[model samples]
Target: MQHIRALSAAKETRLTISVITFDLDNTLWDVEPPLIKAEYAQQQWLLQHRPGAVDAFDHEALLAFKTSVWRRHPALAHHVSDMRTQMLYELQIAGGYSEEESRSGAKEAFEAFLVERHKVVLYEDALDVLKRLAQRYILGALTNGNADIYKTDAAEYFEFAFSAESIGTSKPHPAMFKAALQKTGMTAKQIIHVGDDPDHDVQGARDIGMHTVWVNAQRKPWPSGNKPDREIVNLRQLPEAINHIADAR
Candidate 1:
């Protein structure tokens, strides 16, 4: 086993960890549930608000539409809010609503979908881990996907939340990490980033000198080419990892 150093009590006190940026989606909650629920809610909205239009559409068709849209506007891939609006518009058009009516219905349905989407249950240990870590480090959220952490009520724990939609840069690009550093006014050495993706979170943070913790919740094999500075299978192990890094310093 690769042993990591532990954070000493004195070092933990003196070492000011300016920020702890997190990846929002899988890192906090199991993404599949909320996403599936959102799609279902969106479909239901289409059936009720714009009936007969979906007679020709199905779940696969809806997904295909979204995929095509993203392929055409890759920049909007991370913009979930914009995507929701577009999806509503597409649903209206497919259902045979007039252009003006489709626009109006989309606005209403999109807002409703967002509310339903936020009813997500996070990992069992998510809040506990964040609460413990927040006592020592400045916590923030850095996500490549556009999820409004601010609306989730979990934003209370994060000092700041950033997304590719807001930053104009995505992970593995290095610029997003730099933006997080700028927001906290801390050097790369002062903060650590924790997330599930090796390329986007681990390698991206490590490339810029920020320590990284890989949250391999699924137990997926670590890809051969990219490796993280630290790896843990559960959120329960995170506090220990941070303490280890702090101890080493």
Candidate 2:
């Protein structure tokens, strides 16, 4: 409210926001649950197909190994899906698989993980809200994660989708935002980016002069000095928040 009021006081003219970009993970759905399930599926596949692949490491050790893999390949950090496949391949090698066997086994294991990854449950009223918003705005999905929106229930509503893997960098970086601008041919002022992360969604968009709405479903305190133009507890409150921005002009 403080930020919204400040915008109202400072604005000289009304603004028109034609595009609304969103962060996929934690914004539309709780990502952790699906990710956990997918990881378990991947592990089970490795255990059955490539024996001892994950047997030597517990959860914490596995997580540490994943981090080590990431640290070893900084260039592929932005490409999470590729990084994961690489992790699987390396793990197979460590488990005594031949290089050729590891390559194919890694792919099959990743496929097992990916199939379960798509089974995400959207937040309540999320699809309905998207359907309503799509009528008026050019909706886009901007995510740093590997979630494929096209496989999700909200696919048809998004006019375009961009990911860190697709854009070669993650959010809080300008690459995805700039790509969105290029694709839509819309000014930053005419778009609003919404997401759960303050730094990734709010600060990143605001840095580029785009309006932002922080989806604070958890009712967390504002952790940063830079604030979003609007904040909402749920997707149900989004249209009103967007309306407030449009009308504040």
Candidate 3:
């Protein structure tokens, strides 16, 4: 790896990280609660605006509607906003709504969910660690989700937020990682990708020659023999773990 200035106090012979890319969903925040809330938000909106659909399509029927939408528009699977909108529109149509009515109603329903979705509850120390790391290294976000970095207080600390819609694909795909490097003008070795996923965050960036830090919040077992360069149980440990990686260089 090419020698670069270390961000941490610990010095290394050849520390290569200049930019740090993060995965947003479960990495910085517990996505489950907000997502569950968002779905409920959608359901509430449908209940108010399209009682017919809400009453007709129960849990199982809605699930089948979602499946059909994905089956028809497989590419939208990674684009959260579009996927939800498309699914809502399909459900509206199936509920006896006209084409124009379905489209407009779906857009409105998706907005209800989107508002709740952006109201995320970040993990403990996530913002603090990001602030500490941003002082020395460029910080960017790479994600498959629709979480708008601008909506969060932590937005100011991020240099950029790259997402599936912007990139036309999601993580586990090298193109997402490649896009981050190209946009930042940083070499793979000059960046470290940190996230909670083995495939999307760790393996994808690893394959591109970027160092990886797996934030294992769930404490799940590593699924493969190959492992990330570093692992941490919580966001609080990130700064020190990153420092350790730099020192190892």
Among these predicted structures, which one has the highest TM-score? 2
Q: Model 1 misses residue 168 by how many Å? A: 2.2
TM per candidate:
0.86, 0.93, 0.92
Write candidate 2's Cα lDDT for 1-249 as tens digits: 232234343234435667889999999999999999998899899889899888988889988988989999999989988999999999989888899999999899999999888898999999999999987788899999889889999998888899998889999999999998887767788789999999999999999989999999999999967899999999999999999997885
Worst 10 residues of 3 by lDDT: 1-10
Q: What lDDT is obtained when candidate 2 is compared to the true structure?
A: 0.89
Pick out the ten consecutive residues of candidate 1 with the lowest summed lDDT.
1-10
- Among all candidates shown, the one with the greatest lDDT: 2
Model 2 TM-score relative to the real fold: 0.93
Error of 3 at 122 (Å): 1.4
Give the higher-TM-score candidate: 1 or 2.
Answer: 2
Which residue pairs collide, candidate 3? none
lDDT of 1: 0.76
How accurate locally is residue 39 in candidate 3, as Cα lDDT from 0 to 100?
88
Root mean square deviation (Cα) for candidate 3: 3.9
Q: Quote the positional error of residue 247 for candidate 2 in Å.
A: 0.9
lDDT of each: 0.76, 0.89, 0.85
Candidates sorted by TM-score, best first: 2, 3, 1
Q: Give per-residue CA lDDT, model 1, range 86-135, as digits (tens).
A: 76777678777889988988887776677667776778888888877766
Between candidates 2 and 3, the one scoring higher on TM-score is 2
